[model samples]
Target: MSASKKARAAARLSAVQALYQFDMEGTLMATLLDEFHRHRLGMEIDEEKFEKADVAFFDDIVKGAVARREEIDAVLSQKLASGWSLERLDKTMLQILRAGAYELMARADVPTGAVITEYVDVAHAFFEEREAKFVNGVLDAVAKSVR
Candidate 1:
């Protein structure tokens, strides 16, 4: 991957984690952004070195997802299986969808394919292939509607 591509991938990964923390812990937006910028992005944790992320992209995804959560969630909720509500989703899975949905709805500069693929990769980090494919399916649906 090119440097920008790698950085953006890292940003998407970090943005999902940040959004997950926000969802589960109710961390305030400023606090969430601060924590990620200060301690997580590109920071070594447990001796595992994180790649340098695109800070602006990271901020946009994390901030945008949270800022427009209701809109994003509405789009996501519609794309879910008929009986599966957002609340029924695993929290991490929800964050993946929210971030990906936000990107599709707002980041027109990012191709729909790339948005879906990146979040599918992010989903892979925390889930099995089934969940990753679920992410792909949901994000693809959302992209189709929005983009």
Candidate 2:
């Protein structure tokens, strides 16, 4: 991958992780962003080095997703099938959806296909192929509506 491509992929991964942290820990957005900036981005953990992320893009995604969460969730809820709701989704899946939804709705510069593909890649990092497919389907539905 080119440097920008790698940075964006890393940003997507980090944004999902940040969103997961926000949901699970109830950490404030500002605090979480600061923590990631100060400690996590491009840092090594357990002897594994993280990719150098696009800090500005990472900030935009996390902030945008959090700022517009209710709207994003409503759109996501609609895309879900009967008897399934956002609350029923796994936490990681939920974050992935939210991040993808935020991008589809707000990041006009990014192609819709790119958003879906990136989040599916993010899902693959934490989940089985089935979950990645689920992310792909939900994100495709979300992109259709928002893009």
Candidate 3:
């Protein structure tokens, strides 16, 4: 990938983690973002280095996903299978859907395919290919609704 693409991909992944934290802890957005900036983005832990992420992109995804969560969740809920609710989803899975849905709804600059692929790749980090494909299907359904 090109530099910006690489940075954005990293940002998308980190945004999912940040959103997961937000969901579980209800951390104040400002404090959560500040913590990521100071300690997490591209920072090393346990002797492993993270990819350098686009700070602006990271902030936008985290803030936008949370800020527009109700709308995002509505769309996600619609896309889920029958008998499924947003609450039934894994927390990480919910954030992946939220972040991807936010981009599809708001970021016209990003192609639909890129958004789905990026989040699908993000899904792979925490899950098996089976779950990653689940991410793909949900985000694909989400893209169709928004874009």
Candidate 4:
């Protein structure tokens, strides 16, 4: 991948992780973002060095997703099948969905396909192919509604 593309992908991954952390820890967004920028991005952990990420893109995704979470969740909830609510989703999957929906709704510069693919890839990082496919399907539905 090109440097910028790789950076954005890494940013997406980081955003998902950060969102997961925020959900689990109840950490303030500013504080979590600062910690990620200063200590997490590109840092070595578990003997695996992190990829360099686009700081601005990372910030935009995390901040935008959190800022518009309720709106984003409402949209996601609508796209879900009957009897399937946002609360029923796995927390990690919910974060990925929220991030993808935020990008689709707010970042016009990113193509819809790219937004869906990136979040699917992020889901694969944490889950099996089943969850990745779920991310793809949900984001596709969300893109149709919002993009």
Candidate 5:
């Protein structure tokens, strides 16, 4: 990826982390976003590249994820096994789904392939090859279903 794309990926990862924190901690949306801005030195991947524009982009992704969460989860839940609910998925994987689904649903400017590729890259950063493949498969299914 180009430098700006890499920067955007990092920003998305940070947004996912923030969302995961909120999911686990029950932090208010406004408070969590404020905390994210306030603690940039600690939470950010690259302080030098952080800008107001990136912050706004991250906010857009997070807000979009929250707004379309139920629809996204329903799409995901359909792909799960008989006993599994969306909440039963791994936290990191759920974050990936929410982030990917948000891009798929809300960002008309970003091609579906680009969105899936970016989130798969994000998954690969932390998961093993097999898990990344699983994420890729799930996201592929989600893109097709939601389209």
Candidate 6:
């Protein structure tokens, strides 16, 4: 991927991580996102470069996903393997599903395939190959439902 695209993808991954933190721990989303930026600055990464990144869509993405979490989880509970409930899902996989489904449902400008592929790729950052496949499958189901 191009650097700009990579940065955007990174932002999405960051957003997903923030969402996971909020969902799993009841953290305030605003505090989490701010903490994310603060920690990134502490890490000495280019704050301006990251801030200038195409992440304006992130808040919408995160908020939409959270707002419809119950609905999204219902979709997931229905579409995943028979034994796989949303609560039983791997954290990264659940985050991937949430991120991709959020874009699929709310961001009509983004190609469904792009959202799915990007999130599946993001899943690779923390999951095994098999986990990416699971993400792919769940997101494919989500894409079909949204379409």
Clash pairs detected, candidate 1: none
| Residue 9 lDDT (model 6) | 81
Error of 2 at 135 (Å): 0.6
As for model 1, its CA RMSD to the true structure in angstroms is 0.7
Q: lDDT of candidate 5?
A: 0.78
Residue clash pairs of candidate 2: none
lDDT of 3 by residue, 18-85 (tens): 99999999999999999999999999989989889999999999999999999999999999999999
Q: For model 6, what is the alpha-carbon lDDT of residue 112? A: 84
Query: Residue-wise lDDT of candidate 1 within 40-105, one digit each (tens)?
Result: 999999999999999999999998998899999889999999889999999999999999999999
Candidate 2 runs further than 4 Å off: none
lDDT of 5 by residue, 46-123 (tens): 545443326777888888788778887888888776897877778988988888888877787888888888888878
Estimated TM-score for each candidate: 0.98, 0.98, 0.98, 0.97, 0.84, 0.85
Worst 10 residues of 6 by lDDT: 41-50
- Residue 131: error of model 2 in Å? 0.8
Give the alpha-carbon lDDT of every model: 0.93, 0.94, 0.94, 0.93, 0.78, 0.77
- Root-mean-square deviation of every model: 0.7, 0.7, 0.7, 0.8, 3.0, 3.1
Compose the digit string of candidate 6's lDDT tens values, residues 1-147: 686676678678777877888878988878866777667412446544443334566666777888888888888788888777888877767877887888887788888888888888888888889888888888888889887
Model 6 steric clash pairs: none
Provide the lowest-lDDT 10-residue window in model 1. 16-25
lDDT against true structure, model 2: 0.94
Looking at model 2, residue 1 earns an lDDT score of 83
Range of the 10 consecutive residues with the lowest summed lDDT in candidate 3: 138-147
TM accuracy, model 6:
0.85
> How many clashing pairs in candidate 4?
0
The 10 consecutive residues of candidate 5 with the worst lDDT sum are: 44-53
- Which scores greater on TM-score, model 1 or model 6? 1
User: At residue 69, what lDDT does model 5 achieve?
Assistant: 81
